[model samples]
Target: MGFPVIRNRRLRGSAAVRNLVRETQLTVHDLIYPLFAVPGTGIKHEIPSMPGVFHLSLDLLDAELDEIVKLGIQGVLLFGVPEHKDETGTSACHDHGIVQEATRHIKKRYPQLLVIADTCLCQFTSHGHCGVVKFNDALQQAEVANDESLELLAETAVSQARAGADIIAPSNMMDGFVHAIRTALDEAGYTHVPIMSYSVKYASAFYGPFRDAAHSAPQFGDRRTYQMDPANAREALREAEADVIEGADFLMVKPALAYMDIIRTLKEHFDLPVVAYNVSAEYSMVKAAAANGWINEKSIVLEMLTGMKRAGADIILTYFAKDVARWLRDTE
Candidate 1:
């Protein structure tokens, strides 16, 4: 007979010993709820792809906020589905736009809750692109005009801040967008408004459900031209560096599950807080699999989120925010 000299299972023999030696911890404070707002009264339409999530109108927001706040979630990220669409996405910058109104309502009613507004034009543009597009005569193709798009993105950020957004999250991926929005916000006397830049958002297939929820899929070419390539890791660092230099208060890596390496890289390289978006498609996939009885839903959900935290995500923008918070509370 033989005996092992160092039995690793000794540490796992009890819950107390395991808790004391745990490397990463996930908590309610680490979550930021992503909310979709539409225009209307009494509208709480659930996105079919995302079973438990909803596109709530302003009239029904109170109940939603009440539930979120009661769950101990301190922050929310808002995406607006404007009623009107145009070539320039004019409604996106209007003070009365869906997101603006939602921000104001959320702030007024839940004064302590932090509201992060998604400052982008896709949901408001007729073409469903993140920026303004122009046709190139020589190439006979449409190209996103970077400088012009920056101008509109700045306007959108300022508009969101004026509408009472505590943080302005620019997810458009336009070059110099963070700098442009920072300058615009400061000039407009919103100097205190922080920029949560989507610094390393990839042109990922994991964004499909989000486009359905926000109604922001591009009409023609894909966002690959602007968003980072999933194949590159160094490029993510460069993107994060650019946003940091441009005055981003927080750096975000989108589609957290697939890009945890990027999230960890950004956190290790940058001094600012790192945020990871546990985006819609990621949530939907888990939900679908769990509904099919193929996996242990709750355990997997907690493990996925804890892995993100362990990978260096300081804040997580997740569709599972409320549910995770409730689960954590119940287990505690």
Candidate 2:
């Protein structure tokens, strides 16, 4: 044989050696658990499409937080399912709203846990859109009113902060939304609370399960007018840039698996921490396949999470947070 001096197989010869050469590491601290808060006591209903995820009511939240704390997960992102919905999503701004109430309860019980409130009107809006809608008679269509939505978004952020949220995450992809929210937080004496902007959210089909969880499917048109197109990489950068300039403390890319390139791009372009949302659809697919015996759930999940970290995600907002954390603890 010719001189085969470079033996790449040497590093792959042993499991311990492979692990030693691992390029990325996934840990409990890199996770941000995403929880759904609904209205009721003693209620923990599993989302049908998302196997292990549940919509938890505040009455049972203390025990749930106890379990979460035991898993060594330090952060949580909350999405609220309010009892009521309206044209302007006024309920989202109420200090007594589901998210606000949940925030207060969670923070009071687990003062050390970092609570991030998802600031958006979709879950509270009657039309299930992210912003205020107006019918355009000239075009014979309904569209999100960008400027009108800014005030409501700001109000919602302030309410979340008052209710003890450590961070306000605005997923509503409205123009100038982050700037409005940052100013609102500061003016409301919550300058310490940070804004985690969903800066590169795409108008993706990977949000079906989330709609079921939050009851946020738009009754009319799609969100393409606001959300970025999956085909466009440059637009993602533009969106992230705008949010950064608008004072976003952290930037997030939604439906993380399909947007790993976007995540990498943002991490390379920005100095701030990059968050990736391993969205409900992504979770559901894995769960469904695992339940059907199509894949080894644990192994695949670890691989997927490690891939996200390798792609430069500083934080991962995932439905598998609790399970993954437990698995890590047990394995370790």
Candidate 3:
């Protein structure tokens, strides 16, 4: 029908009508908050690059966790900033590691809250790369040892599962990471825990604030060696396919705002749940614009997240999870 014959304005005539005809509805249940956990007695230092997001100590988590639970956020993706770093990231797999201890504590207190441990070695490695590094004699520079790194990743995943993590999210971008972690989890009798692989993480400029927040900036080289290039869309599918074949329960695309196409592509191709990480720089940009009175933070955030949902994201891991939950509650 033509526009005059079937006027679209009729449906848009009223807010109630618009609400009734809304194609996508974003809810608190679709949100997963990302949290930073550092080892200490009492500390809640906010990252300068990412405002309103704090690097919390284990003792300070009660208040944050309580607020999250009250706001009805389903889960949190946890990253640990250890005080110690080594070549192999041995601290990451220790029984009393920062993340392992934090996992145990959170599960003990809030059994209902899902804790997803980020299984990676960047923050625990002295070199600040995601994996073990070796001097490539031919290349005349250090390169990440992919196969050797898988053992540490597997150990980290099993350790997290043992510490009561509900999910293991590997963000290292290593080849066969999902397979290694899955095998390790099954062998350790943690087959129930699922792997949320960062299958299509791109080497983009959007991770500056996150590196500050997690204290995981590469000391010498960039992550382009392992992380996917942002220019190629077809490569995303192949990356996701590998993880799916390796038994990843959820496939994730990092820095979601610019890569909504990738999110929809994965959703269309994959049968599993597709998660979009609304990354640090995305959040920081909004905050910066809002601070200058250039935009309405609440409305912009709602619209942005809605757009993500409309793009076919089943779940979103975002720094704005708590705020979004509150906004939803207040409106209700």
lDDT of 1 at 104: 92
Worst 10 residues of 1 by lDDT: 1-10
- After TM-score superposition, what is the CA distance of residue 86 in candidate 1 from its true location, in Å? 0.5
TM-score of each: 0.97, 0.97, 0.98
Which candidate has the top score in TM-score?
Answer: 3
- Score each candidate by Cα lDDT: 0.93, 0.93, 0.94
Error of 2 at 128 (Å): 0.3
Q: Compose the digit string of candidate 3's lDDT tens values, residues 233-273.
A: 99999999999999999999997999999999999998999
Residue 201, model 1, lDDT: 92
| Candidate 2 TM-score over all chains jointly | 0.97
Model 1 steric clash pairs: none
For candidate 1, the per-residue lDDT at 39 reads: 93
Candidate 3 residue pairs in backbone clash: none
Summed over model 3, clashes come to 0
Higher-lDDT candidate of 2 and 3: 3
- Residue 18 CA error for candidate 2 (Å)? 2.3
Q: List the residue pairs that clash in candidate 2.
A: none
